[model samples]
Target: MAASLIGRHFFIQSRNRRTLTLKSRLKYSSAVQAVSNEDVESLYPPVKPRFPPGNWTSMTEEEAWTRYEAMQEMTAVPTVKERLEKLTKKQMRAYRFPVNNKSVRVLEFQKNVTKSHLIKGLPTVYDSLQVDSLILEKIKPYIIEVLLLEKERLFRSRFRDIHRDSLILRNLIQTLLPLLYEHNTALRTSQVDEEVDIKGFWDRSGFKRVMWYDPEMERPKEFRIKYANDVRFQTAHVCDVSIRTENPLKEFLPIDDELCINEEFPVLEYHPKVFGTSKTDREKSQLTPGYNLGDPCEFGLVSFHNTVWLDYQRRKYGDAVTEEMRQGMGLTASFTWLLAQAYSQGFNSLLDVTYPMTTQTVLSDGQKMSFFAYQLNTIDMLKNNMANPRQNICWYTDETQLYEKIEDGKVIGFNDETCETLLKFLLMKPERRNINMKPTLPAESSDILSETEFISRNPLDLSTETN
Candidate 1:
């Protein structure tokens, strides 16, 4: 056994030595060598196995069809989910501009706005629509009958839990709209939507409407949709009553493309809504404008707004600031309604309107009403791209008094011009002016509407035709 063990040890050592000698010899022999082109060519025979050559001529019909299908598969549009994944961005916090955003109310940012400034902010032309005193007098007696009746209804309002101003405004609209129905047949066909959920976006580049945020107070926390991936004011101004019609009202004024093609516009330096801000709800953010250039929306003839948001504004900020806020409400509502309609029709901040859309706003506290006529000529005023020459037009007037006071149930000092103006707005018919509008609602593409539901919102009435 001892002899065997010693022999095995010697055998192991010899094997180790032999292995090392072979490894070293191999390492020494290994050297880099240049291969002749001839040797490399020999790796592949001239006649290789691919498709047996002359056996196949041109592609057959079946092969062509298969190839065409393959090409189509390769070039087809991405799936809806894939498109959404690529188009939608990470949820971002944004500024919301509610009709009565409390932050804006307290911040008093709108006090900086004026007629010319708003025109510049919107980059729109401005005009004043006023009746001559003599003309107002001539029609005063005829309109006074309805004015007195509206005043009576105004006094009869049961303010109850509702705010005084809101109630008065409601009563005034209820009493006055009927006169429109009696005067114009077109108005009778109009649809009235109350507290319509209005939402949209506008470039808040300060432009002519420059305003600074008060850093002393916490910044306002409101967010709206982004425009072409840019931060814009999400105008969610509420309309007390929106009168929708099949036809859009005629444009009050149209600027010639050549005349104002080189006109200068006001530039806003800062948008106050972005300052002292808070985090926003990313879930509500929607990408817009570029995709909605030609969609049709419900036409709004007249929108009524209430000064209820301006609570005690008269005393706290004084009449000047109060007036500013009032103008802001009317202006914001007017712009947002048109924008929302434009959005419905696929006209967004990224896409300007092909033709003008008109809407009238009545801002009131029951007694005094401020009227504004807005003609949205263009909406492509995004900060990065404002090359469009046409300016939007808004015709506005200071508060027109319906009456001075209600003395012992008798209306006193009723203004004839105010009544006349209000009636004219109500009488403003939706002339058969048609713009390219998508009959289907935006939400129809999703689960928001069914076939039956789509038809209801489908204003074009193509149901009878075969596809």
Candidate 2:
């Protein structure tokens, strides 16, 4: 074995030395030089392969079919098992089924299972799902119907409540109809001669006369002629009737003597209901300056007949009483006669007197009397002469006065002074006297200034002296 090994080693070494010598010889040879350039070019030439030209241009149809079949056989083909495996993978991915255990796999499984179940079980589940959907749909409509019915019930309840309240209010107002009618009648009657349109006096309805005791005249007199519809119109259509006594002695004998007996006898005591307790004796004292006292003849025997003619002409002509009447009766007599005529014409209220009292009278028996006379020209004179001429005046005890306008038996004007005077008069000794006076000031006098002296003054300096 040793000898064989030695021989093999020698042979291996000899072969390697020979191979190296050959490679060296080849590296240095000219053949290698020629091959370096032309060998690579010859192996891969730029030109395409050339073939010999033939008379046949193309293969016949059967030959071509055989060639195509052989070429197809040469291409790769997948087996049925391989194709099945690929299709299975694609299906698994598409349906998102659990190939591996994960949340993604669970969600995929749930979606596929639910969808498949819904589609496959459609026939059995359809009726149950439809019932649930129908329940959901009907719920909203049913709730809305219930709400609407409840709202209607609430609205009807409220309407009935308001209707009941209105009926109650109407009944209450009806109960007050009589008192309102009577009060309104008295007001209209008192305002007859104030240039008020008597046609509209009673709210399109005629008046019902109310009778009351007249202590002054000692007779049962008609206090007011009231209209039925006056309450609705808020209007007064009262005519105060004063009965003229044929026997003055019968009415005045007892009362006059008692009142005249003592200066402090409290003239208001006789008619405690008509006049309240006296605040001061000054109201019952002898007449003050600018006031008339005593009987009618003490000043002058001025008959109503004489003054009636002057007033008639003055009212008709709207001018001064005639000179004949003035000379025969004098201004005082003419005015007195005019007052009597006005009083006889149902203007017996002191407020209805058109003229101021000029003189007072004293009788031999110590009885005191005062007279208010009217002249035809008195209203014109007041309109033309008074510094702040107004439609009417309400005289109070302290010479405080209310200027007002009388229209349709309504005082349409009012002012601070007039309102104050009215309030004072309402609070006077004879509280019943306030019943005859209107509580509200006339609307016309509301914004009127009692004097124009401020207007005539210098605006810049507001001084009394003129520039």
Best by lDDT: 1
What are the runs in model 2 whose C-alpha is more than 4 Å off? 1-189, 196-338, 341-415, 423-467
Model 2, residue 295: distance off in Å is 26
- lDDT tens string, model 2, 210-234? 2223334421244223222101011
Give the per-residue lDDT of model 1 (tens digit) for 399-454: 77787886555667987766767766766666775544432233333221222343
Off by over 4 Å in 1: 1-90, 101-164, 202-229, 255-263, 271-279, 286-297, 383-386, 434-467
Model 2 / residue 90 / CA error / Å:
99
lDDT of 1 at 437: 45
Question: Where's the lowest-lDDT run of ten residues in candidate 2?
Answer: 360-369
Best by TM-score: 1
